[model samples]
Target: MINFYSFRDLTRHTLLLSFIFLLFLGEANAGVVVGSLTENFTCDGQIYQTFPTNGDTKLFEAKLDESGLVFTPRLSPNNESIEVQIKALLPGANSVSLTNSLAFNPIDNFLYTVVRANLNDGKGKRLIIFRIDRNNVVELAGIPENNGTIIDEAGANVSSSGLVAGAFSPINNLYYLTGVRKPVYVVDITDMSFKKFSAHNFNIADIAIDPVSLSLYASNKRNSSNQLVQIEFDDINNPTTIVRKGNAAPISSQVNDAVGASYFTPAGTYIGYQNKPGKIFSINLTTGRTTVLANGPNLVFNDGASCPFDFEVDLDNSTLTIVADDAIADGVDINTIQATLLDVNGNGSERKEVSFSATNGAIIGSCTTNFFGKCLVNVTNVKAGISVIGATVSDGTLTDTVSVTFIPGAGDPLKSLITANPTTLVADGSSTSTITVQVKDSNGNNVNNGGDTVNLTASSGTIAAVTDNNDGTYTAIYTSATTVGTATITGTLNSIVITDDASIILKNGAPDAGQSVISANPTTLVADGTSISTITVQVKDVNGK
Candidate 1:
């Protein structure tokens, strides 16, 4: 029994044990791996690891067995007294760079941290820049702090072109270092030239640029408190204390050890944080209302030992990555973990299904929600003639791929019909004539009250009064005064014109008494052709002759 094991079996067993030991040690040493992504293998669920420490030069690398993809992160060695805070990490042509006030580039294989001596003279305030290439080589791209004459030098920090999040001005292809402190600096990367825009008084923690609006949002953290202040970087660099004092959570409770970790979401709808417990909070930029989204075990803070220093969000994946310190004392380990994919597509069974008509300007239906979230946006305002109708469903995480189509049919064209009542009438002097016009569309539907206006104009007669009854009918009164002619009335409704003609005759003084004709000669003619005296003489002659 003592000599039972074969050499081959023993060798295999040893190799397996060694691999397991390496895996366990790697997990233990890697610290607080919060990042924009996590790789998932189809076979095993082992997460790739990459994290940066305050004063560590050896960049960590973790290789998973499933896909043969090597995940390596470059780190800058800890300069304890120097206190090089990693504000931003940008990838370059062949290398990666770390930046604080000064830029630090990692040597090949993350061997040693080096500063560009030519770029930084160690004299006036300077900004250092290093870029990482695809091969993971670090390159020092000189980003001078202030090469031009110093207009003001009070509370200014040098920024490089790589601050990727916020709005940038194309007028100056540079990075803006803005704060509530004195003499804010704008350094252009092209010429390595800088100009003092204005004075900033507070410590500028983070800067964000709104590309669409071309606005800058700078978040400031005061000395001792967790009170976050926001300043708008307009033309004048005006400071408006957005997060007022005593309104924010206590400094100890909110930011932990990492100050100024707060930033707005890309949409500027929410403000979130990394490296602090329950740091992600939704903020209404207008009202300054803050609400915590998801906060629990996953968001534990490192008390400076392994502080969650920086964070970024991959909106496409709906995942957030938080970078933290990998110090030994805090027991914080860095390992990329799979994101919990949440199927936000709500229950489709209970939804009200609708079908839209092929008619133009038809409203299919409307959607409303009690929760604030993005909806599926597939319906177009333009007409596609008779085409398939498809609905878009989004849960802020995933969108629907299925689309619905609507069949096309011949439809009536929209029209406004104007009909006038009393098509024909006889108009006379001192006679009241009323005209009523109704407006409807070609489909025999009454037009909306707010849609059209009706106007009645009379050419030959005077319109005494015009009244709009709001039921698409307009009453117009016409007064005829001695004008014996046809009174033509034109009704215009919604640009459609129609005319009605009415004939009027002025009789001789409104029919004489007893139908007798009295001329200017004071003689009244009877039914007979002779006058009254000739009638009396004829009656006497008829009796004699």
Candidate 2:
């Protein structure tokens, strides 16, 4: 009893079935369906495959095969890994490094591969560079720095020197390149004029840079084992300290050294690394959990373990593209939720709190938006039933919300978010800021959690009181005595974290809002009827503006 249907038809049928099942379960009374969401794609019109187990679920990648189009699987390691397909092979070029010397610039949105000229000059080895994209590939020229002395043994090419590791820094927006023994090179993407970083003596094996946190992670092998370390640019523009994180993986009595490294920008906190044998392993820094997401063929780095792995992470869409069909966006246990805040003009809204809570599951994550009026949150403890989500947003004065529900059937159910409004409030003296929260689900439906517990806290301000709206909504009243300071309010729904940052302005009193119009002495001055009467009026302000 097999009925064949097209991929598009299958998707519609699946959604239809899920909708029917949800109706029988009965909607929660606490949740009110205020509005519906129509925008499903990201700001760039991209879609994320959020752990949908069913066939024909929206996928982030497609393979161009003879069959026309095929969706790629994420969790299965038997298939190809994501990074292998994205690495642009530069052997087609004239002179490029045959080694793993590639980096992806999140700002420039370009993939660059480094190669050294074959000349045997001790210092003036011209740097051969290539900037690659999907349709166009251009070669760029760069000159290498002498760095006091060039280590010929660190050569990546037949020439005296080579590029072994490279990464992009979100802090200074600079591209960092390094060899076995040469000092770290910081090259400005625009000017390409590069300089060595602090003239360090350590020979970095490979490097991974977190785009959002701006932390530099590098590894060097000690006695056949690898030691993972984090480099902090206390000044950002300058490197000051290095903190060792011990072994990246378990250092058994048996030797195991991690070689290649790449940063996953969408998660903003995890790294894809490989030790001996080149199997791709993703390590979650937030949870301290590591899992093998992809199996590798015979690939080797310096100690016959390192391999070149590169892929593009679109933070807005939360998709890993340009990788092979074997990319694993599914191994992510962190729930990356997204919410769009808008104003009356239908533009991106500001200073909003976006939070989610499931009626029968655990919620996780907290985030705020930039000027773009959007945010990505990671949620956990997802169940296969209906989930409620809430949000609150303010324009530095007042706040509002949108609550909805989602039926996450074997997939993630949390969507949307917002933040505390009126982030800036007047200091004390009978002044209070009201914090409001709204809940919603992934499909834009609203669900009630029977006055579910919503966690709230503030860093500098006092949360004097809180009131539950009884309908998946709550308000926290806070007053600050500090003259000039900022308070950060953090809320948790189940496990999902929602945050709001507010500023308190200290003043003698509120300045004059406007002129107070004084009434005339004669209530009804009848000038035309019988007698003409003089009228007196005055205008005044609290500050006499």
- Residues 405-477 of candidate 1: C-alpha lDDT, one tens digit per residue: 2222111123333333434433445555676655544444443243345666776656655576765556677
Clashes of each: 44, 41
TM-score of 2: 0.38
Candidate 1 shows a clash count of 44
In model 2, which runs have C-alpha deviations exceeding 4 angstroms?
1-96, 119-125, 145-159, 171-173, 198-204, 238-255, 302-545
Off by over 4 Å in 1: 1-54, 57-125, 133-136, 145-172, 179-182, 222-230, 233-266, 294-545
Instruction: Point out the worst 10-residue segment of candidate 1 by lDDT.
Output: 301-310
Best by lDDT: 2
**Lowest lDDT 10-residue stretch of candidate 2:** 28-37
